[model samples]
Target: MSVEIKISLNKGLYLKEPQDSKLGRKMIKHSIMLIEKFGFEAFTFKKLAKEINSTEASIYRYFENKHLLLLFLVNWYWEWVSYLITMNTMNVIDPKLKLKIIIHSFVAAHKENPNVEYVNESKLHNIVISEGMKAYHTKDVDSENSKGFFKSYKNLTTSVSKVISEVNPDFKYPYALATNLFEMSNNSIYFAQHLPKLTDISLKENKVVEVEDMLLYFTNKLLKK
Candidate 1:
């Protein structure tokens, strides 16, 4: 498959933009609504423009195509997740505690973003850390098809791994744990048929909090070993 990419490395982030800016906040917000309503594949410049009360040409002026729009949306999620982890775990001096907090945050966000793109976002981080992203962009790259779609995943792993190392001076296989965390969190929410539903609570309702509780429970249990 010929994958067409649409990211502007030079563009400002949507999360930080002013709400009323023409090609900034309002656009991002509306675009998200469009995605939430129809998913990323069904989202088109014509359809999104109609929903946002704008022209297709105007939408194109910001994003060249759906792929780029997807890249933008994926980047927004990573930035927001990174910001939340930093803000929430800043004061904790214990690396182990910080790791716990970070895991808590990841599980919470997984429950929060619950979509195909955010799932793609999970892959993106792994790719970034492994330099698989650069390979994807390379014309001479081999077996690029199996390389997966994550461009930001490596950074996510590095960040998470660093915290893991902090938690346990002897921690091995940080990336494996990162991968597991991503799979576990993502599966629990998005891939619901394979996941068992809750007893007295709904995973659909209070997702983040429930994920947080689960993460804390897992960490406390595992760390005791």
Candidate 2:
């Protein structure tokens, strides 16, 4: 069964909400495909407009620039993962178990969800792994942060951090650990696939059990103390 998910993101990220119109949605759908195919630096409004059968001016109507468009996609991804965590951990009372489920959700969220026909979660996950940091690692990040542009990512971290606190109230670095686990899930997979020397896990075909096991191992070891 496929359910429609509507994720509300920061208004500052776009001049117009891309989800509200067919052309806007087409712009987003192709933006992801273009970015994933050519990488972010090579992606441009001109190319996107050509690919989507729209004009550069039309693309500009939806987004101020390509950077903001990237941020919008990245923020959407963070919210999706957060939603998955909620769904996966629902009614699970054990904090340790909930944390375990979070690890699974982090890994599993990379898989495609049929519900969101426009956004390919798998390709978006790859984009997040490779190009996500560019969204905030900029001189303008502080100004953007002031406008709540990064709230979706922060909210995802906070939610996981709360579960970490529940598992061990005395754990002093819940937020750090929470964010690290999520980053590690993405990083380790990227490393295994492209830079195998950096990670101990070996990449296999369409499976990430090693990444899940490694995250669970670390979480258990850290929280057991």
Candidate 3:
């Protein structure tokens, strides 16, 4: 299947929809690069504005703060991931195979998308590994949750949990497993690259292959009757 370049994001993620305007698109595109380059702590609207040759005030018109911008970017990524999972597993009837396909698609998501010019999937994956959780780890998490700020992520988890149920109706931890599957996909990569001591996988080797193997092994081992 062809890679989709554009996906509609939740309105709650942004003060103004970046995908709606040329400058907004530049803000989103440059912000991804800047966040990946400097990490979320050092990334700012002023830095982003300089990178995009726009004013910080213009950027603020779209996002109330840098935290919200990160939320928007990270949520956009999760929605894309949710789409990829659905498209790839739609035709597969076997629950085990569907789970395997989900794992593989996630490993592949660490790579760049040639068709999507506005955002780099690979860089976005790094941001997710490093800073994605901060989006929800705020004092306003309850308020954001009430606003459906995490709907895309929850939808993805729910989708994966359904496959877990199909694989083993008696499994008591489908939601836990589903959410771990999502985090492990990125966390494993992060550990492999930055904290090799935390993981058995090595960055010198094909990290994606190692992560896929490890995920499949644990998943199959856990799900097997």
Best candidate according to TM-score: 2
Model 3 worst lDDT window (10 residues): 108-117
C-alpha TM-scores of all predictions:
0.65, 0.97, 0.95
Local error of candidate 3 at residue 199 (angstroms): 1.2
Question: Residue 42's C-alpha lDDT in candidate 2?
Answer: 100
CA RMSD, predictions in order = 9.5, 1.1, 1.7
CA shift of 98, model 2, Å: 0.7
Model 2 C-alpha lDDT per residue in residues 1-225, reported as the tens digit of each score? 567988889999999999999998898889999999999999999999999888999999999999999999999999999998888789999998999889998988877484867899988988998898899999999999999999999999999999999989999999999989989998998899889999999867858999999999999989885
Compared with the true structure, the alpha-carbon lDDT of candidate 1 equals 0.54
Clashes of 2: 0
* Runs with alpha carbons beyond 4 Å of true place in candidate 3: 1-5, 112-114
Question: lDDT per residue, candidate 1, 1-225, as tens digits?
Answer: 443222233243223322335555456666666665555557688887777777887776666666555555655455556665777787888877787778776765533333333134444433222222232354533442334334455566678777766666465676777656655554454434233553222366434566556656665565543
Best candidate per lDDT, number?
A: 2
lDDT of 2: 0.91
